[model samples]
Target: MKIVDVICTPGLTGFYFDDQRAIKKGAGHDGFTYTGDTVTEGFTQVRQKGESISVMFILEDGQVSHGDCAAVQYSGAGGRDPLFLAQDFIPVIEKEIAPKLIGREITSFKAMAEEFDKMTVNGNRLHTAIRYGISQAILDAVAKTQKLTMAEVIRNEYNPGAELLPVAVFAQSGDDRYDNVDKMIIKEADVLPHALINHVEDKLGAKGEKLLEYVKWLRDRIIKLRVREDYAPIFHIDVYGTIGAAFDVNIKAMADYIQTLAEAANPFHLRIEGPMDVEDRQKQMEAMRDLRAELDGRGLSVELVADEWCNTVQDVKFFTDNKAGHMVQIKTPDLGGVNNIADAIMYCKANGMGAYCGGTCNETNRSAEVTTNIGIACGAKQVLAKPGMGVDEGMMIVKNEMNRVLALAGRRK
Candidate 1:
C-alpha cells in the first residue's frame, strides 16, 4: 500500500535523563541539587519535562503506525528546544518530506531511509530529530506490513541469517553523594543481573585534581561492593570535554589526567568519553586520533569514545576509519532513522572500531523501546537504557524487547 498522509502530534513531554548518574557540575537536573556550590552556573539541566512530537502515518488503507521524537535537553543543532523543533519541523514535514513520501512504495525500510536522507541533503538541512520521527513512522508502517519485529526486518534486509543475540546492557550510575552512590552500587551489582558495564559520563567542571580524586573513590567503592568478585564490570566515564578544557590543548596535561584515571582504575579498564570537544568534525576527528595514538603510545588501556561532534553516519565513519577513537556512539536520537543506527554499528564492526548504541535521556518509553530493539538486533556493544531518570525504566524496556525478540526468533526458526 502507498502512503496517504503524515500527521504529527505535539505536546508530548519527556523527563530529562540523569547526567552520568553523577551529581552534575552546575545546577542539578530537574532542579535537584546534589552539591550545593551555589554559583548561578546552571551547567546541569533544570527542566525535567519538555514538549515533544509523535509522528503518525495514515496509509491509504487507513492503517496507522507512529513514532516518537527524542531531543537532547542542552545540545542539538537547533539548541535543545523541543517545542521550537516541533514547531519548526511541521512545515518541513508537510511541505518537503510528506510530499516526497506520499505516493512512495514502502517495501524496503533501508531504501526509504536512504532516499529520505538524499532528499534532505544540500539545502534540506532539516534536523535529525524531525527526520527521526518521519523515518520511524514509515518503518513502523513497514513492520506492520511485513508482520515482523523491527529487529527481524533489519536482519532480513542487511545481514541475512545473522544470529540475534542479547544486547549487553549498561546503566548510568555515578552519584557524587555517598548515599546515592551506595544505592547505585547495590542496584547495579545485585539488582541488575546482566549489567556488565557500569557507566558515569557527565560534565565534571574544571578541577583536574578533584575529578581524579573523585573517580578514584568511585572505582574503589564499586569494586568493593560488586557482586561478582571475579567479574569486574567496565568503568565507563564520559567527561563531556571538561578534561580537554582543563588542560587547554596541553596534550601532556591531558595525558597526566588519563594516567591518573588509569592508575586509579587499574586492573579494571576504563572507557573515557568526550575527553575533548571541537565544533568542526574534522578537527574533532583529529583531536580524537591524536589522543588515541597518545594513549596507545603511553601503554594506557583506556578506551576513548567520540560522542559530541560525530552525530551522523559519515562523521562516525570518519572517526572509525581514521582510528580517532576506540569506539563511537551511534547516538540514536542525533542520527535518527533506526536503520541508519544499525548501519553505523555494522560499519564500526567492519572497520574494527567499537560500537555503542546510545540515545539521549530526552527520549520516551516508546522511543527507548524502539532503540533497544534496534541496538539488540544489530548486535551493538551496548544500548543506553533511556527516556527516564533512573535506569530501571530503560532497563525494563530493553529486557522486555529482548525477551520478545527471542520469542519471535524462536517461532520463525
Candidate 2:
C-alpha cells in the first residue's frame, strides 16, 4: 500500500508533564499542581498539560493508520529531548515529514522506521516524540497492508519464533499511592503500586524511615485484602533516586536499606527502580553495578532496575553489558522509534536481563496500546499500564489491548 496523504492534529495527553528536577528540588504540591518556579528548561510551569500530535497516514485503499507523538512526563531532564509542544512540532510534520511520507511504499516497517528515526534536521535528529509517533504510523500502515494485527507484524519481522503471549502488567500509583494500591489489588496487577517516591525528606524520609513504613503498610494491605493467597504481586517502586540521596550514595548503606525494604515486603518480591541517579550516565551505571554486587554479596533477593540515563538502545546495551541493574526499563518514547523498543527488549532478554516495557504516564492511549503490542511481541518481562496515574483507566487500556491481540493471534494459530 502507498501513503496517499498525511494529517496531523494536536491533542492532550492523559496526564500532565511534571518537571522532575523542580519536584526533586522541593517544589511543594498545591492541589494537583506544584507551587514553585520551573527549573527545567522549556517548562513554563513546574507542571503543565502534556501535549501530543496525532500523525495519520491515508493509505491508497482509504484505510487510515495513525500514531500519537508524545514525550515523557519529566521532559528535558536526565539528558532527554526538550519539551514537545504540539504547536512547535505539528508544522514540522506538515512541512518536512509529510512530504517525505506521502506517496511512499509501505513495504517493510523495519526499513521505513529506521530511515525516519535517524533522519535529522538542523544538524540534530528529529525529536524523540516525532520519531516515536511517525514510527507507530509506519507500523500501523504496514500492518494494514498485510492484513495483520500490529503484534503479528512485529513478531513476523523481529522475532518470528517468539510466542504471542500476554506480558505481565505493572500499574503505577501517581501520588495517590495509598488509595491506588486498593485499585491495583482489586485488579490483580502482576506488578503493583509503582509508588512515586520522588522526594527525599518527605517521601523517603531523612533516614529512609517513611518508605520503610510505606512498604510495610503495602505488604499488610495486600495480605489483608487479597481474595486469594496466590494473588501475590511483585512490589516495584520507583524511588527516582531518593534512596541514594538518603543514604549518601554509599553502596553498603543503600544495600542495607534495600534489604530492609525487601524484608518489609516479606514474601513478595521487591524491585527498586532509579535507586540513585549520580547525574551522569557512566556514574549511574557504575553505582548500580556496585549496589547490585553489594546486595548479591549479602545474599539479598531484591532486584535493582535502571531507569534514568538509560534512554536509548545503546544505553540499554551499555547498562546490560555492565550488569548495572537486574532489569532495565525500556522507556518506549525515549528510545525514539518503536523499532528501538523491540531491539532493546530482545537485547536485554538475550543478555539475561529483565526487560520492562515502560513509558511515561504523560502519553496518549494510542502510544500505550502500540507499545503494549511491541512489548508482547518482544516478550518483555512486564508491560507498564500507562497514560495516566489513575489505576483503573490505564489498567483497562493495557489489559484489554493485550487480550484482544492474544485472542486474535490465538484464532489465527
Candidate 3:
C-alpha cells in the first residue's frame, strides 16, 4: 500500500492541571499570578481556554483513522502560541504529509515512520509535533489495518510479556496553593491505595510534626504498595522547583529526604524528578553528584532525573560524564525534535543511563500521543505525565494503543 491522504480535524482546547492553586512567582517570588485574568502587573495568567486539535488519515486501501495531535496544552514549537502551531501544522498535514502517503504501503511501521521523518526533514524546519501527528495517526491506522492491538505491536517488537502497571506521578499546577508540602505528600501516598487507607486523618493539620508524620506515612504507603503489587509500579515525583533546598548548601537535606523516601518505600524502588533552581549545568551536576553520593551511602538507589537543567545535548553529556544522575528526564520540545530526543535517549542508553519521557501541565491529547510515540521510539522505560494520564484525547489515543498491544499479549492478565 502507498500513502494516500491526511486531513486535520478542527478544534483545539487548553486545559491547566496545575497542582498549585495559588499564584506563584515563577522565579524567586517573581510575583506571577494566574488569577484567570488577562493582565496582572507582575503575574503571568492563563486564560484557561478549551482548545483542541485532531487529524484524520486516509490510507491507500481506502482505510481511515482519526486522532489528536495537540501536545500538552502549550506544546510543540510555539508552545504559548498553540493556535499558530495548529494553524501552521494542520495545513502541512492536509497539504503535504497526507497527500504523499495516499498510495504508500502501510505494512511496516518503521517505513511509515521513516516516510514521515523524510517529509519532515525536507520541509527544512521540522517540528516534532508534526511528525508526532503522522506517527500517531498512522499507528491508529495500522492497528486498524492489521487488526493488531498496539500492545501486540509493542510486545512483538519490544517487551512481549511486560505489563503496564499503574504509573503514579506527583501532579504540579502552575499555582503554588496545592503544594502545601504535607498535603501534597499525603495525597500522592493515597493515589494507589485510597481504598485500603486514607493517609490523611479527619482532623489532620499541617505543622512540623505533622509534616514529618506525613513523610513517614508516605513512606509506609509506598512500602505497602510494593508488598501488594506483584510488579513494583514506578512512582514519579515532580518537585516543580518547590524544594527550597539550595543546591550547594542543602545537598545533604535533599539526600536525606531521598533516603527517607527510599527506605520507607518497601520495594526500595523510587525515582525523583525536578526542575530545581540549580541555575546552570555545572551546579546541576554537582548537586546530582552530592545527592547521589548521599543516597549511595545509605544503600538507597536513586535515579536523579533532570528536567529543566537538561535543555540540550551538551547538558545531557555533563550529567552522563559526571554520573550526576542515572536517568535523563527528557521534555519533548527541549530535545528540539523527536529524532533528536531519540538520539539523546540512545546516547543515554549506550552509556547505561535510563531515560524517561515527561510533559508539562498544559498538554493536549494530540501532543501526548505524539510524545508517546516519541517515548517508544526513544526507548523510554516509562513516561511521566498527569496522574489522570489518559484524560486528554491525545493521550487517550496512545493509551488505547498501548492497551491494545498489552491486551493482545495477555499482559493485562
Candidate 4:
C-alpha cells in the first residue's frame, strides 16, 4: 500500500500532565490541581491538561490507519523529551513530517518505523510523541495492507516463532488509590494497585510507615473482597524513589523495609518500582543493582522494577545486562518508536529480565490499544492498563484489545 494523504488532529489525553519535579519539591495538591510554581519548562502551572495529535494516513485503498501522539504524565523530567503541546507540534508535523510521509510505500513496518523514528528537524530528532504516534500508524497501515491483525504483523516480522497470547494486565490507581483498589479487586486485575506513592512525607511517610500500613491494608482488602479464594494478584507499587529519600538511599535499609512490605503482602508477590531515584542514569543503575544484590543475598523474594532512568531500549539493555532490577518497565512513549518496544521486550525475556509493557496514564485509547498489541506480540511479562488512572476504563481498553487480538489470531489457526 502507498500513502496517499496524511491528516493531523489536535486532541485531549485521558489524564493531565503533572510537573514531577515540582511535585517532588513539596507542591501541595489542591483538589486535582497542584498549588505551586511549575519547576519544569513549558508549563503555565504545576498541572495542566494533556494534549495529543492524531496522525492518520490515507492508503491507496482508502483505509485510514491512525495513531495518537502523546507524551508521559511527567514530561521533561528524567531525561525525556520536552513537553509536547499540540499547538507547538501540529504545525511541525504538517510542514516537516507530512511531506516525507506522503509518498512513502508501506512495505516494511520495521524499516519505515526506524527511518521516521530517527528523522530530525533543526538538528534534533523528532519528539518521542511524534515518533511514537507515527510508528503506530505505520504498523496499522502495514497490518491493514497485509489483511492481518496488528499483533500478527508484529509476530510475523519480529518474532515469527512467538505465540499470540494474552499478557497479564497491570492497572494503576492514581490518587484514588483507596477506592480504586476495590475496583481492581472486583475486576481481578493480574497486577493490582500501582499505588502512586510519590511523596515521602504523605504517602510513604517520613520513615516509610505509611506505605507499610498501606500494603497491609491492600493485602487484607484483596483477601476480603476477592470472589475466589485462589485469586491472588501481584502487588506492584511505584514509589517514585520516596523509599530512597526516606532511608537516605541506604541499600540495606531499603531492602529491609521492602522485606517488611513483602511480609505484609504475605502469600502475594510484591514488586516495587523506582524504589530510589538518584537523578542520574549511572547512579540510578548502580543503586538498583546494589539493592537487587542486597535483596537476593538476604533471600528476599521481593522483585525490584527499574523505571525513571530506564527510559529507552538502550537503557533497558543496560539495566538488564547488569541485573539492576528483576523487571524493567518498557515505558512506551519514552521509547519513541513502537519497534523499540518490541525489541526491548524480546531482549528482556532473552536476558531473563521481566519486561513490563507499560506506558503513561497521560495517553490516548489508541496508544494503549497499540501497545497492547505490541505486548502480546512480543510476549511481555505484563502489560499495563493505561490512558487513565481510573482502573476500569484503562483495564477495559487493554484487556478487550488483548482478547480481540487473541480471538482474531486464533481464527487463523
Candidate 5:
C-alpha cells in the first residue's frame, strides 16, 4: 500500500461539564457516572465546545483507496492556556512526514517507522502527536492491507500482550476518607433520594476533607480484603498521590504506608499517579531512585509505577538509566504519537521493564478504543479503563472493548 492522500477534519474543541448535581445527589453506579439530577445522562452529554483538528489517512494500492483516521481534541488543564496542540502537531504527520511514506514498500512497519523518525528528527514540536496519529493510521493501514488481525500483527512484531485487569483508586486530597458521599452512595445503592435532593441544589459539591474521608473509607474498605478473596480479588491501586496526611510523606512513612496497604489488601501492584514537581531529568531519576530504595528497604515487593516523570522518551531513558522504576505509565496524548510511544515501549521492554498505557478521564470512547488497540500493539502490560468506572456508560464501553480483546487472547480460558 502507498499513501495516496492525508486529510484534516476541523471542529470545535469540547468541554466536559459533568452533572456535579447528579454526582452530589445520587450514589455511584458501577464506578462510572452517578445517576441523579446534576450529572449529564451519559457520555454524549460530555460535549466539545471549541475547535478541534482531525486528520484522516488515505492510502492506495493498485486500484483501491481507503481512509484511516485520527483526531485530537484539545483542552487546557491546571488553569493553563489551552495546550496549543493539533495544528502544531498534525503537520508533522500530514506534511513533513507523510510525503516520505508515499512511495516506500509498505511491508516493514518497523522500517517505515524508523524512516518516519529519522525524517522528523524527533525534536519537532508536534513530533509525538503527529507520529501518534500517523502511526495509528499506518498500523490500521498495514493491518487492513495485510488482512491480519491487529493482535496478530502486534504479537508477530513484539511480545504477547498481558492479561490486563485494571483497578481504580480515586484521587483524593486528605484526612477524611469519605469525602464524596454522593458518589459513594451511588456506587453502593441502586436508587437514591439524596441524589434528588443534591441535584436540586444545582452546585456540584465536594468538601476537601469529606473527599479525603471518602478516599480513606475506600482505602480502608480495600484494606479489609484478603489476599485471595472469593469476591474482591487482590488488584492494583492508582493513587493520584494526594493523602490528606501530607503530599511529601517521608521515605520511611511512604514505605510503611505502602507496605501496610500491600500486606492488608495484597494488591497486585501500586501505581502512584502524579503532580510531582521534578525540575529536570536528574531530579526525576533521583526521586524514582529514592522511592525504589525505600520500597526495597521495606521489603514490600510492590512495584513503583512512574507517571509524572516519564512524560517523554528522554525521560524514559533517564528512568531506565538510573534504575528508577519497575514500570512506566504511558499516556498516549501526553507523549504525542504512536511511533514515539512505540519507541518508549520498545525501549522499556528491550531494557527489561514493563509498560502500562494509561487513560484519561476526558477521552471519548473512539479515542479509548484506539488507545486500547495501541496498548496491545505497543506491548503495554495493562491498560487503564477510561471515562473512569464512575461513568457507567463510558465504563461499559471500555470494559466491553477490554473484555473483547482479553477474550480474543483467551484470558478467561
Candidate 6:
C-alpha cells in the first residue's frame, strides 16, 4: 500500500509531576543533588503531566490506522523533555516525515523507517516522539493491510522462524523516581501504590538502608501473594541506579548493594536494572563491566540490566557485543520504530543476551498493543505494560493482546 496522507493531534494523556527523588542513581538523570533528604533536581510535588500525539495513517486503499507518540516520561534520564518533545511531532510528521512517506510504497516498514531516520533536523536525529509517531503510523497501516495481528506481521516481516512465545508480564509496582505518588494515584487501583496487582510500597518507598529491610518484605509478600504455592516469583527490580549513585559509583559498594537484594530474593535470582548512569557511554559501559565482574566474582546471581544510555538499537547492541550488561533493554521508542526494535531483540537473542521489551506508562493502549506483539515475535524476556499509570491497566492491555495474537496464530496454523 502507498501512503496517502498523515495527520497529527496533540493532547495530554494525563497529568504528571516529578520530584526527582529517585531511590537509586536516578535512572534517566545522573546529576542528583540532595536538598536535605530529597534530591534537588527539579524537586517539587506538583501534579505530574503526560502528553501524547495521535497519528492517523491514511493509505491509498482508504484504510486508516492509528498510532501514538510519547515514550515513557522518565526517558529524560538522558536529559530530554518528553511532553515538550511530543509537541514537535505535529510539524515534523506533517511537514518533513509525511512528505517522504506520501505516495511511497510502504510494504516494507523497515525500508520506510530507514528513510524517516534520514529526515533529520540539522544533522540531528528526529526527536524520539517524532520517530515514534511516524514509525507506529506506518506499522499500523501495514498491519491493517495484511489482515493479520501486529505480532504476526512482525514475525512474517522480520525474525524468520521466530517463536511467538508468551512474553512475561513484568508488573511495575510502587513509585518511579520521576513520578509523584501523592498526585499520580489511580482512583481505580485494585492494587494500591501500583495500578497492577502487586503491593510494593514498602519496597519502593523506603530509602537507603530501609531499602534492604523493605526488599525482604517485598520478597516474602511476592512469594505469598503473587506467586503460586509451588512456584517462586523471580524478583525483578529496576533500581533507578540509586545504589550506584549512593555508593559513589564504587563497583564494590554497588555490587554489595545488589548482593543484599540477591540475598533478600534468595532461591530466585534478582534481575536489577540501572545500577549506574555515568557521564558518557564509555564510562557507563566501564561501570557496567566492572559491576558485572564484581557480581560474577562474588558468585551473586544478580543480573545487571543496562537501561540508562542504552537508548537506541545501536546502544543495546553495543552493550550486548561488549558483554557490558547481562541484559540490554530494547526500549521500543528508543529504537525509533518497532521494525528496528524487532531486529534489536533478535540481536540480543543471537548474542545470547537477555532482551527486555519495555515502554513507559506514558503511552496508550494502541502503542502497548503494538509493542506486545513485537516482544512476542522477537521472543523477548519480558514486556512492560504501559500507556497509563495503573499497572493493572497496562498489564490488561498487553496481556490481552498477547492472548489474542496467539489464539489467532493457532487458528492460522
TM-score of candidate 1 versus the correct structure, residues matched by position: 0.80
Give each model's clash number.
2, 0, 46, 0, 46, 16
How accurate locally is residue 127 in candidate 1, as Cα lDDT from 0 to 100? 66
Tell me the whole-model lDDT of each prediction, alpha carbons only: 0.69, 0.94, 0.50, 0.94, 0.48, 0.67
RMSD to the true structure for each prediction, in A, is 5.6, 1.3, 7.3, 1.2, 9.4, 6.2
Name the runs in model 5 displaced over 4 angstroms: 11-52, 61-105, 121-127, 160-216, 219-249, 260-270, 350-352, 377-379, 387-390, 403-413
Give the per-residue lDDT digits (tens) of candidate 1, residues 217-269: 77787778878777565667777677777778566778777888888877777
lDDT of 3 at 24: 30
Q: Native-vs-model 2 lDDT?
A: 0.94
TM-score-wise, the better of 1 and 3 is 1
Evaluate residue 88 in candidate 2 and report its C-alpha lDDT on the 0 to 100 scale: 95
Q: Give residue 341's error in model 3 in angstroms.
A: 6.2
RMSD of 6: 6.2
lDDT by residue for model 6 (1-413), tens: 77788777876653243434352433343343222233424433222466678888788889888777765655444654333344555776677677776787767667766677456777887777667767777777777888777777788777777667787776565445113222212222111222121122433332246566655665565455542454454556676666666777888877877788788867666787777768689789889988888888888787888987788888888888888889887777666666677888889989988988886666777778888888888788878766565455676787789999999987887
**What is the TM-score of each predicted model, taking all chains together?**
0.80, 0.97, 0.65, 0.97, 0.64, 0.81
What count of clashes does model 4 give? 0
Global lDDT for candidate 4? 0.94
List where candidate 4 sits over 4 angstroms from the true fold. Answer: none
lDDT of 3 by residue, 136-233 (tens): 66666766777665424433444334444432322332222223323334333312211111112211121113323444555555545443444343
Better of 1 and 5 by TM-score: 1
**What is residue 15's positional error in candidate 1, in angstroms?**
2.8
Candidate no. 6 TM-score: 0.81
